[model samples]
Target chain A: MSFTVEKTIKTCRGKLLKLSHNSAALNCKMVLNVYIPKQFYENASVAKNKIPSIFYLSGLTCTPENCTEKGFIQIQADKYGFAVIYPDTSPRNVTFPKDCKIDPNDWALGEGAGFYLDSDTLENFQMGTYISEELPQSLASSTDLFEDKIDFLKKRSIMGHSMGGMGALNFYLNSFERNSNGYVSCSAFSPVVNPTAVSWGQNAFKLYFKDYEHEGKKLDPTLILKNKDFSDKNLNILISSGDADPFLENQLKPQNLIDVVTKKNIKGIRVNIEPGYDHSYFFVSTFIPEHCEFHAKKLGLINHLIK
Target chain B: MSFTVEKTIKTCRGKLLKLSHNSAALNCKMVLNVYIPKQFYENASVAKNKIPSIFYLSGLTCTPENCTEKGFIQIQADKYGFAVIYPDTSPRNVTFPKDCKIDPNDWALGEGAGFYLDSDTLENFQMGTYISEELPQSLASSTDLFEDKIDFLKKRSIMGHSMGGMGALNFYLNSFERNSNGYVSCSAFSPVVNPTAVSWGQNAFKLYFKDYEHEGKKLDPTLILKNKDFSDKNLNILISSGDADPFLENQLKPQNLIDVVTKKNIKGIRVNIEPGYDHSYFFVSTFIPEHCEFHAKKLGLINHLIK
Candidate 1:
C-alpha cells in the first residue's frame, strides 16, 4: 500500500507528483501521477473540506506522464478545488502465462493495453481490479500528500481518452449504481465505446481471456449502457469523439452509443462529435475544461456556485 | 516564401498550424508553428482590426515544435486575440566551411544553436535576419492564413526562453529605438543575460565570429541594456529566472541584469527571480500568462482594459 514519490513538479496553482507503488492487484509495480491543487496548500478550512479527486486514464502506448504533461487539466482542477489522478494504462514488468502472453509489438495486447478489465485467467493484466478497487484505497493512505485532506476513495469522478476512454465507460457501466463508492460521474474523449463490437476489443479479448463470451460481455459499455437505469437522473454520462479521428469508422464507433441513447432516450447521457478535431492530446486538451466543469458540478466542487 | 503545412491541430480556443518554409535569409528550409486564435473566426470587423503576433524564440537544441507543444502560450494568445509564432532555434540541412563548421555532436555551436544572430563567417547561420526581419515579411505575405488580415510585421511583441531570451533582449535593445516595425515590448524566461561573461556565449561567439570580442560584445544583453537609453518611459523589459536553474550562477546570470538596472535606476526594466523554478518549459509555461498580458497591453490587444 506504500508509494514512492518520484518527482514533484510545480505546475499552475498545484504540484504534479510522479509516484510509483507496488500493486497487489496486478502483482507488479505501478506508476501514476497525481496533481494536488493549490487548495490543499491553503488554510485549515480548505483542508477540512476534504477535496474530491478526478481520475484521468490515458490511451494506448501512454505512460502516466503523457496526459500529466499534455492534458492541461491541472488548471481546471485548481480552479475547482479538486485533485487529479493520472494512472498508468496497463501493468508493466510482470510475468504472463504462455497461453496468455501476447506479442510484444501488438499495441492492442501485452504491456500498454490492459483494457481496464480483469482478465479471465491472467494475474498480471488485472488492470480493472488495480484501478477500480485497489488504486483508490492505496492512494488514500499511501502518502503524506493526501493525509486525509484529499478524498481519493469516496468522492471521485472518472474520465479517459481513447483506450482509457473505453476503460472509463466500461468501469463506470460495470460499477455505477451498484454502490456509493462507484464514480460520481463519467466522461470520455474519443473513447472506444463498442469494444466487443470493435476489432481492438475483439483481439484483446481473444488474447486476454479464455472465456471471451462470458467475461468480455460483462465489461462491454455498449451492452451495459443499454441495461443501466438512466431514470435515476443523477447518472451523468458525457461522451465526445472527434469527427476527424482516424479510427472513427472501424475502431471508435461512438455513433452506436449515440444511436442507443436516441432510440432508448437515455436521459443523462450526452454525446458530442467535435468537428475538424483529431484523436490526439490537442483534441483532449480542448475539451478538458468543459469536462472538468461537468465533473466539478457533479462532484459538488462548485456547490457554492449552485447555491 | 511558400509554406507546407505539416499538421493543423485544433487546440483550445485556437488551431495550431505546424508549417515549414524556405528561408531566403538563412538559405535553408525552416520550420515554424503558428497558433491562430478563435478571434479570427468571429467576424470581418475583427479581421479588419487585425490580430497581433507574438514571436517566441526557443533556447538551444529546440525545434519549432518544442515550445509550440510545451510552452502553453496558446491559452494566453486566444485570451488576448493574438497569434503565436514559434521559430526554430537554428538553421538545418545546410553545409558550412571546415574552419567555420562545428562538430555535429556539439550542442552549443551546431544546427540547433543559431543564437538568433548572424554568423560573422557562415552564411547559413543568419538567424538574426531570418527571425527579426525576414520572418515577419514572409509570414505576412506567404499564405492566405494571414492574407493582409493578421498583423505580423506592424503590431507585434517578442518573448523567449534561455538563449532565445538573450536574443529577445539583444534584438529589442538593438532595434527598438531605430525602427517603427520593432517589437512593442520584450520578455524572457531563464535567459542567458550576459553572454559575453558565460562559456556558452564565449564558445558560440568564437565559432560564429572570427573577431569574437568586437562582434560578440554587441549581442550581449548585459552590455546592451547597460548602454541603451532607458529614458523612454514606454519601453518595457520583463525578465524572469528560476532560483533552482542549474546554470544560474555561471551561465544564466539574470541577477547581473537586475544589478545593472538597480544601479542605473532603469525605470522600465523588471527582473524576477522565481523560487523553486527550473530552466525548463514547466517554468516558462507557469509565467507565460503574465507575459502574454504584458504584451497584450503593449501591443494594444487590450487597450480597452486600460482606463
Candidate 2:
C-alpha cells in the first residue's frame, strides 16, 4: 500500500498531494492526486469527524493532472471540508501488449482511454475493480496522512466529466451498489450518457470486452440501470450537460439517461442542461461547487446549507 | 484596433473571451483573455456604473491560457463585479528575424519570456508598452460587448504572479505613474521585486536593453522605486510570497521590495510571506481573492464587506 509522493502543492486552504503507487489491479504503476482540505489540518484530534472524500475521474485523453489543474475543485473542497481524489484515466505502463485486442495507436482504446472498466480480454487492466474497490481500499489503509481520518472507502461520493461521467454512473449503479459502504452520491458534467450507443464507447467496449461471456453488457450504465436494484442507493444522483457542447447530440446524449430514469420512475435523479456552456473543463468547473454541496449534504459532512 | 474573438467560454456567472489583435507596439500579434463578469450582462443600460478591470500578467514561459485556466480569477471577478484581462507573456509571429539581441534558444530571454517590457534592442517586442498602454486603448475602443462599459482605462488595476508580478510593480510604479488615468491598485503573488539583482531579471534586462542609452537603468523596479515619486499613488500595493517557493531567495527576492518600502517609508504597501506555498499557480490562485477584494474596494465596485 506504499505510495510515493511526487509533489505536494499548496492550494486554497489545503494541499494537493500528487502520488503514484504500484497497482495490483492494473498490474502497473498508477498515478493519482489527492487534495486534503484545511479542516483536516485544523483538527487537533486525528479521528475527529473523518473527512468525506469525493473521487473525480477524468475523461478521455486525460491524466490526473488535467482535472487537478483545470477543474478548480480544490477551492470548493476547501469550502466544503471534504477531500478530493483525482484518479488517472488509465494505467501508464501496461505490460500485456499482446493480450490487448485494441491497437496502441487508437486514441479511444489504449492507454489514455481506459473507459474505467476491467477488460475481459487478456489485456485486462481491471480499471473498474481498481476504481471501485482496490483504489479506495488502498487509499483508506495507507498510513500516510493518517488515512483512517479520511473516509475514502465508506463515506465517499463520485463525480466525473465526459467519459468519466459514464464510469461514475456505471460504477454507482452496478459495482458500487454491491459494496456495503459504497458511494453516497454521484454527479457528472457533459458525460457520455449512452456510451454503448456512441462510437467512442462502442470502440472502447469492442476492444476491452471482445471475448467475454457477459461481453460489454455489464459495463453499460443504460443497460445496468434497468437490471440493477438501486434500493440501497439513497442519495440523489445529479447530471449536467452543456447545450452548446458539440458532442451533446452524437456522443453525450444525456436525454437517453433522462428517458431511462423517467420510464423506470427512478427516484432522486436530476439532469440539468446548461445553456451556452461547452464540453470543456470550464463547463465542469463552473458547476462543480453545486455538485460538491450536493455530495457534502449526502456524505453527512454538512447538515446545514452553505452560502 | 480590431481584435479577433478566438473562443468565448462560459464560466461561473461570466464568460472568458480569448482574443487576438495586431499590436502596433510589439510589431506582432498579441493574444489575451478577457473575462466579463455577470454584472456587465446584468446591467440593462450602458451607464449603470461601468465594471472595473483587473490586468493579470503571467509568469515566465506562460501564455494567456495558462493563467486563464489555472489562475481561477474568473469566479472572483464575478463575485466582485470586476472584469479581468489576462495578457500573453510575449509576442508571437515576430516578422523581424534579426531585430533582437537574445538567442531564440534561451528560455529566459526570448519568446515566452518577454519579461513584460519593451526592448531597445532590435528584438524588442515592446510588451511593456503593449500591456500598459496599447492593449487597454484597443480593448476600450472595440465595440464587441460594448467594451466601452468596461473600465479598462481609468478605473483599472493590476495583479500578477512571478515575472508578471515584476511587470505589475514596475509598471505601477513607473510607466503607469505617468498616465493621467492609470491603475488604481496593484498586487503580486511571488513577484520578482528586485529584477536587476536576479539572474532572471539580469538576463532579460541585458538582452532587451543591450547597448541602449537607458540600458538596464529603466527596467528595474527597485531602481525606479527609489528614483520615482509615488506621492500621487493612492491605492494600497499588496504582495504575497510563499516561504517554500524555491526561487524565493535568489530569483523572487520579495524582501528587497519590503526593505525598499520600509526604508522609503512608503505608505499603503503590504508584503506577506505565506507558509509552505510554492511557485505554482496554486499559490497564486490561493491569494488571488484577497487581491481582488483590495482592488474592488479601491475601484468602488463594492462598498460593503464580502464574505
Candidate 3:
C-alpha cells in the first residue's frame, strides 16, 4: 500500500496530490490524482464529520492530467466539501507482445483501454479489481491523504466518463455484493452503459477475456442492472449525455441502460440528454455541477444549490 | 472584418465560438475563442440591457485553446452575464526572418510572443493595435457575434495571465487614451507589471521594438500607473500572484505593480499574493471566480458572491 507523492499543487481551497503507486492488482506502477478539499485540511485533526470521497474514472486516451487540468470538479468538490480521486485509466510502463488479434497501434485494446474490468485470462489486466478494490485500499492506508479525515472505503461514490461510465455503473451495482457499505451513489458523463451492444466494448472485451461473448455480458452495466436488486440500496444514479455527441448513436448505448431502469421501475436515476453538447470535456464540465450535486446529496453533504 | 467560425462548442450556460479572421492591423490570420454567456443567447434580439464583454488574453506559447479549454472561465461568465474573448498571444505563420538576434527554437521570439505592442520596426506584429483596437472593431462588425445584444465597444474589460497579463494591465491603463469608454476594469494573474525590469519582457521587447529600453517604459503597467491619472475613471483593477509560481520572482514582478499602486495612492487596485499556488492553469482556474466577480461588480452586474 506504499505510495509516492509526485507533486502537490495548491488549487481551489486545498491541494491536488499527484501520486504514483505500485498496484498488486495490475502489477505495473499506477498513477492517480486526489483532490483534497479545504474542509479536510481545516478539520483533518479535530473533526466529528468525516469527509466523503468520489472516485472519478476517466475515459480512454486519457491520463489523470486530462481531467485534473480540465474537469473543473474541484470547485464543486470544495463547495460540497468532498474529496475527488482521479485514477488512471489503466496501468502504464507495460511491455508485452501483441495478443488477442490486437494491432500494434489500437488505442482501445491495450494500455489506456483497461475498461476497469478484471480480465478472466490475464493477471495484468485486472483494472476492475484495481479501481474498485485495490485502489481504494491503497488510498485508505496512505496517511498523507488524511485517512482519518477523509473516508475512502465506505462513505464514497463512483463516477466516470465514456468507457468509465460503464465501469462506474457496473462497479456500483456489483460493489454491494462484496460489501454492505458500497458506493453511496453513481453517475456518468457520456458513458458507455451497455458494452455488449457497442463496438468499442465488443472489440476490447474480445481482447481482454478468452470468451468475450460469455464473459463480457457479466461486465455489462445494463445486463447487471436488470438482474441486480437495488430496492435496498435506493440506487442513486445520474447519467448525462450530449445529444450532439458523435458516439451517442453507436458506441454509447445510453438507451440500453435507460431501458433497464424504466422496465424495472427503478427510482433515483436521472438520465439527462443535454442539447448541443459533444463528448469532449466541454460536455463533462458542463454537467459536472449536476453530477457533483447528485453525489453530494446522496452522500448527505450540504450543497448550496440543492437545499 | 470577414470571419470564419472554426467551431462552436456548448459549455456552461452558453456557447464557445472558436473564430479566425484576417487581421488588417497585424496583417495575419488571427484566431480567437469567444464565450458568449447564456444571457446573450437568451436575449440576442429583443433586450434592453445589453450584455457586456470581457477580453481574456492568454500567455506565452498559448493558442486560444489554452484558456478556452482549461481556463474554466465559462461558469463565471455565465454567472455574471459577461462574454469572455480569448485572443491568441501572438501572430502565427510569420514569413519574416529573425532580424534582431533570435534562436530558431526560442518560444519567446517569433510566433507566440507579440508582447501586445506595435512594432515600430515591423508591420506583421501589431498585436497592441490588434487586441486593444482591431479585435473589438472586428468583433463588432461580425454580425454573427450578435453585436446588437453584446456590447463589445463599451463596458468591456480586459484581464490575462503572464505576458497576456502584462498586455491586459498595459492596455487597460492605455485604453482610455484611445477611446473614452475603454476597459471598465482590469485584472491580471501573475502579470508582468514592470516590463522594463523583467527578463521575459526585456528579451521579447528587444525582439519587437527598435528602441526597446526607451519605448518599453511606455508599455510598462507599473510605470504607466505612476504617471497616468485614474481619478476620473475610478480605475478598477485586481491582481493575484502565486507565491510558488516559478516565474513570479524573475519574469513576473507582481510586486512592482503593487508598489506603484501604493506609492501613487491608487484606489481600486487590489493585489493579492496567494500562498502555495503556481503558474499552471490550476492557479488561474482557482482564482477565476474571484476575477469574474471583481469584473462583474465593476460592470454593474450582480455577482451572487459579492452581494
Write down the lDDT of every candidate, Cα atoms only: 0.85, 0.82, 0.85
Give the range where candidate 2 chain A is weakest over 10 consecutive residues by summed lDDT: A210-219
Query: Model 2, A1-307: lDDT tens per residue?
Result: 6788998888898889999999888888888999998878876633567888999989988999888888988888877788899999988766655645666676777788989988876354678888988888888888766457888877788998898998888787774556555688999988887777889888877777765326566767777776676656564689999899999999988888788888888788899999999998888889988888888888776663354
lDDT of 3 by residue, B1-307 (tens): 7779998898887998889998888787888898988888775432667788999988888888998889899999988888889999888887775565667698877688888999887678899888877888878877766766778889898999989899998888887787744898999998888888978888877877888888898899988887778777678889999999999888888887778788878888899999999998999999998999899989888743344
User: What lDDT is obtained when candidate 2 is compared to the true structure?
Assistant: 0.82
| Residue pairs whose backbone atoms clash in candidate 2 | B99-B122, B99-B123, B100-B123
> How would you class the docking of model 2?
high
> What DockQ would candidate 3 receive versus the native complex?
0.82
- Model 3: clashing residue pairs? none
Each prediction's number of clashing residue pairs: 0, 3, 0
* Candidate 3 structure quality by residue, lDDT tens digits, A112-191: 88899888765688898888788888788777657667888899999999988888888888877877448999999999
Count of backbone collisions within predicted model 1: 0
Q: What class would a CAPRI assessor give candidate 1's docking?
A: medium
Model 3 C-alpha RMSD vs. true structure (Å) is 2.2
lDDT of 1 by residue, A79-153 (tens): 888999999988898787766557788887878888898886677888988988899988888657677788887
